[model samples]
Structure formats: C-alpha cells, structure tokens
Target: MGVCFSTIKVSGSNSNNNVNHNRKEATKQQTKTTKATAPTRKKQEVVDHQQNNKNVNNEEEKKLKVKEKQGSKAIPCGKRTDFGYDKDFGMRYTIGKLLGHGQFGYTYVATDKANGDRVAVKRIEKNKMILPIAVEDVKREVKILRELTGHENVVQFYNALEDDSYVYIVMELCEGGELLDRILSKKDSRYTEKDAAVVVRQMLKVAAQCHLHGLVHRDMKPENFLFKSTKEDTPLKATDFGLSDFIKPGRKFQDIVGSAYYVAPEVLKRKSGPESDVWSIGVITYILLCGRRPFWDKTEDGIFKEVLKNKPDFRRKPWPTISTSARDFVNKLLVKDPRARLTAAQALSHPWVREGGSASEIPIDISVLSNMRQFVKYSRLKQFALRALASTINEEELADLKDQFDAIDVDKNGAISLEEMRQVVFSLSNL
Candidate 1:
C-alpha cells in the first residue's frame, strides 16, 4: 500500500523570509504584552489566551501520564476484560528481535521452548482494538488461518495466545522476504514471461483455493506474499488476511477495502466478491511482466480512476516484445466486466499460464465443451429463425442486422470465423 512520491523543494529565500516574519510577529506580540495597560481589552484577551494554553498543557501532561500507566499495565481500555484463551505464552516461547510492525501490532521472531523451533509471533496491542469489530477481525483472522492450515501456499498457523494486554498469534516464519522485495531486486524490475508465469501460477492457485473455501482476500498484493526461503525455487506463501472475509455465495462486500493500485472496478463501485481477488491477481501479473503498474498516478484517487476508466497499455516497449499469448492472458484477466473476466481456476488453465507457460494445448474441461456445443446448437436454431424473419422484412430492417454482424467480424473479412464465434461463446458461457 506504500506509494513513492517525488520530493518538493522550497526556495531558500521564501523559507527564510517566512521564518523572519514569524520571529518579528512573535517579538511584536511580546512587546505589546509587556506594554499593555492594566484592565485593558487586549491585556484581558492575552491573559485568557495564556490561561487556555496552561490548561491545554496540563491536559496533555495528564494524557501522557495515563498513557505511561497503560503501558505499564500492558492493557488497553476495553469493555471486554477477558479473552477465553490460554495465557501460557511466556512459558512456551522465548520472544526475540522485532521482525516488523503495523498499525495494530508488531511481529517478532520467537523460539519454542519445547522443540527450539523458530516461529513468527504477531503481538497485537489490545489498546488498538478499541472497536468491537476490531476484536472480531483478529478472531476471524485466526479462524481463517486455522482453517487454511496445511495448504502449501498458505502460511502455517501454530497457535493463538492472549496475555493481559495483547493477543499473540504464532505462525510459520518466512525468511525469504516479500514478493515485492524480490521483484524490486530483479535486474530490470521485471520477470521474463516464463518466470512471471511461474509466480503468477502460484498466486492463481492461492486465489483459487481461497475462492473454493468461500473466502475473499480483500487485499491481494505482492506485499502479502512471502517466499519460504532464499532459494531460487522457494515456495511462495500468502500472508496477512486482515482485510479478508468469508463471503457467502452470490453476496457482495460493500466496504471499500484493499490497496488502491490493485483494487477492482466493482470494488470502487461498492460491490465486490471473489472476482475482486482475481482482478488483484491480474494487477500483480501485469506488474510482474511489465515492471510498472498497469494503472498508476501520484495519488490513490487518481489510481482508482485509472483502474476504473483506462485499459492497460500493451503497445509500450516491453509489452510490444512480449508474446501474443501473454498479452491475451492479461487482457482476459483485466476485463472490466467481472463476469467476462477469467476466474482463478480458468486463469490457471489459460495456455500462457498453465504448467508455467509450457502448456501447448488448451485443456477444455468436458463440461465446458459440452456447454459450448449446446450453445452452438442454440445459436444455429436462432439463426434459422432470424433468417426466416429477414426474408419477410425490407432492406431497412436488414441494415440493422448487417451492422451487428460487422461488429462481430473483427477481421473485416465479410464473414465470421470460429475464432470470432469462440469469443462470443466465451463471454456467454461466463454469464
């Protein structure tokens, strides 16, 4: 979610002038206060201002004292006093150096006493969980992680423990750094199509699995994926399910969540489902191959506008050199209409992505082929009926039909081919 912006410079003359002006104003005010007559309006106003300042200072000091007391107790102000969980974190693990920190908590390296296993411990301060929904988010994250345990692409969850002031979540430690770090470390900030395919394939599988479990990872970005090790062929593990939710069938989430760059069009429109996750994966795939964001700007709102209104540029230098199948793969995934967009499972089967781009033939599932055949049969029947009606109609009515046909005939060959029909059929099938 981090964005880099260019630094702005201020003229030295302007900066120095402003500082001198401020200092002059301060001196004038001091001189006026010192020369003010007793019981004057200006003197009374200054006295009132001084009293207000003192009051504000006293309040701040009290707040600081309260914060220090809270720090000592290690407890936050909350309605709920006790979490029905084990409090044996100190007995089981020896906490180590800090690994990272976020809004709600900090993650640290910890060693299990029983087996000396190195683990990542996430310590979330209870003070930060001020709202009821905040506490629910933590509980849901732990539950989802527990449910998704044993999946090769997901980070393993070991245990959840709570002390007086914080909740400790112990999970598998990944030392290979974030996926974003890996991409930034690359020679040109991009991967070859084949290498990109390998990374994207794993991401698609994770998305597919999450969808299968009826979960939607609201935030799906490179930063959320971590490598298991520093090896060249290290396994990628998905982490940080803070924004994720378990969605029911046919339901859409209304909240606007997720990083701006990877958010889907439907999400900005206030209706999102598992399809949003696929859109995020598509953004990631685009970055992996191009070394730049498909939709980007100086601000988050500008990025969202680009995502909703603009198509990814494929005529640029690297994109022009990229393969046709790879472009096709990205096009399908980045389709604005979520229904027409490729599902995670379908994306995994795409020729450019299947088997890490080594797949030679399109593997059409029997059911999909059967659906296509039935669609063809129905289309033929409709065509016959339309032809019969056309014979009875005049040239003016036939003109409308001609325009429609021309639209479908993308090659302008005066006839539609199987490839054109397939495109129509693919959109229909998704619907």
Candidate 2:
C-alpha cells in the first residue's frame, strides 16, 4: 500500500543510478500480492491457524463506546462539491490533503469537525471494483482493521461507511508520515544497530498482535508502517490492510501479494503463513541498519529471484559495525524455510531485540570490514578456492570468514556457483 521507495546501492557499486532507475520503474508497476493468486499456484490443505484464537473485539467495543460518548457520528455533508468531498461525511470529518493511494484506494487526511481532531480517510471507489475479488479484498481489509482496532501498534479504525460512489475508512492520522520517511530523515542518515533493534522490536510486536488475532499482513513493507507523531520514539503503527487476510495459524496462504523486496521466499513458492511477515521484518531490519537492501537487483523480477534464493550479505561494510547478536537475529528470520523462521513473538524475545539500545555500544569489527573489501574483488574461481581453503582453517579463529563464505554459497551445495560469484562480480563491474 502507498508503494514508494528510494533506491539503495548494492554491494561494490560506486553509483546509485541503477538503483534509482529501478526504483522508478518499480513504482510504476508495484506488485499487489496477486502473484500467488495466479491460476498455476497450488493450494495446500492445512488446519486453520485461527482455531485456537478468539476474536479480540472487546477492545474494539470499548473504543467504540468511547467514540460514541464523544458524539463523533458520521454526518452527511449534503451534495458532493470540492472535487468529490461530500460537503461533510457523517457530518463529522472535513477532508483535507490527499495523502496517498494504495492498491485498492486513496487515503486522505481529514479534520474532525466536532473537536478539530485529525484523522485519515481511505476512500475506495466503488466503480473501480469490477471484479468480485476486488470487492472481497476491500471487505477483508475492513474486517481485519475492525478486529485489531484498539491495538497500540495498529492504526485505530474509527468507522467504515459506504456511499453510492465510495467506501470510506476513517482512522487516526499518522502526522509524522511513513516509517520510511522517518528512517530516511534520521540526522545521521542511518540507524545504529541498537536503533534498528528498537524499530524491529516494534514491528515484531505489531506482527505478533496481528498473528494472534488470526490476521496475516500480506504486505508488511516499511511503507505500511507509520509514526503517530514527530517524536523520535513515537510508536510505530502498522497500516494498509488492503492485501492482508485472516490467515489461521497452520493454514497456508497462496496469494502472493506484497512489495517485491519484502515478499518472503515461501510467498514466491506459493505457500505462506504468518512467518512470511517475519521474513519481511528481517528485510526491514537489514535496511534499517545499513541504508541498503540485503537482496537487490536492477529489476523487480531480479529482486524476486534474489529474495527467493540469495542469502543476505552480512559481511558487507555497515554490517561489520553491527553486533554479532544482531546478525544472528537477522539470520534466523531470513531463513529460507518458513517453518524454521523465528515467529514474531520469538523475534521480540531475541537477544538483539531484548538488548535494545545497549547493543549500540558494542565495538565494531574493523578487520572484518577490511576482509570484506578484499573479498568483494575476488574472482569466481578464487571465491570457490577460498571457501574450500576456509574449511581447512580453525573454525573459531576465522569464524566470520567461514560464515561469509557459507552465505555466498546460499544454496548450501558446498560449492559456490558462477551465478553466485557473478552477484559480487557484477557489482564490482558496475563500479
């Protein structure tokens, strides 16, 4: 939802022009989680993940009572004027700025007339819903938002109303804007490992809440996360459920809907569950610390291929500044096997996450960075020979190198393929 992102230069590249060009192209043709909906995708039969979970509407009901006490009812503003704004929707909100558009609709910032409170109104045009699938997608989004209404890490859903032309979804406005913007705006231009831990912890909490409520946020990109205000530590709330679904725990989801960079390996394989969201969080964590993507290419299809196969390069520059515990956490989440990936709750409890801001004080590994610089320039034959040589070295003394070698051998075939070596070679040639 609200798909937009700046380009991130890949390893060994001296220019970000290719990244910027690809980002522009990707913005024009954003993937909307329908890849899994293809006819050839196979459906798997598994027990529902929600059978053991109860709906959390008690919080929603309490919030509703509070809103009612404030007399915040949607009032008709009479005739449509001002470029489609109902003079007054439910007689309460006066639409303001056009925030952004998602896969199924547009979102606007609106003013609450009664007390001047700001809110976001997502408008889904009825005429655009020519397919039954599109209509159901809208309904499912509304349902998931209503179910997770009062969760602190979720954007609160105030009301959902339908008119002849559009379906309006009103909720709290995130004035600080997208989490991506906030991350980009950081004074230092990048988050420290500790700072990234805080962000990832918040993301996991939201994911944990959503999963517990039997919902899977099919699209968990940074664009879907928003800061409530301008405060540095403002709570991050997950938004835009357009591609989300009520996925039960054990049941698999075949719909391949999500941004290319953050989509999980299983989602590409046409079988996914809540763990898919965790994989996305891992990608976010990787970007948060390094100001680059772990898996990136010049095209969306290339990016998808990398996500489905390539292992994250934890031996890259900025990564040496990150803590061992932090790398360990990311490794666990980015696991190719969804079942082996850390659950949201488990990620929240990770040593890196639990350590929080304290992890920033850990000393950087200067030697590792020097080693990476040399490693990046290695030839395909040399890379393979080095890996073979690494196996003969004392594992404890050269543990980091051993791990780096293994990461490049992503397929775990015990030998690095020319295709794998080309990933680094191509980046170097681009320089």
> How much is 288 displaced in model 1, in angstroms?
0.5
Give the clash count for each candidate: 0, 11
Candidate 1 shows a clash count of: 0
Cα-based lDDT for every prediction: 0.79, 0.72
Worst 10 contiguous positions by lDDT, candidate 1: 1-10
lDDT of 1 by residue, 70-146 (tens): 56434434325466668999999999999877657899999999999999999988866654566888888998999
For 1-431, candidate 2 gives per-residue lDDT tens digits of 12222224224353466557666677555554346454334332122323223244566777879887534222112112112323347677788889877434789988888899889999877655543455767777778988998888899998777667677889989888776566546564434566667778888988999889888887887778889999977898999888788876567976467877788999877689999999999988776665567888877679988987789998778677677787888899999998788899988888888743345754344443333233233323554675577557652345345457677876764345567898968878999
Residue 172 local lDDT, model 2? 86
**Model 2: what TM-score?**
0.63
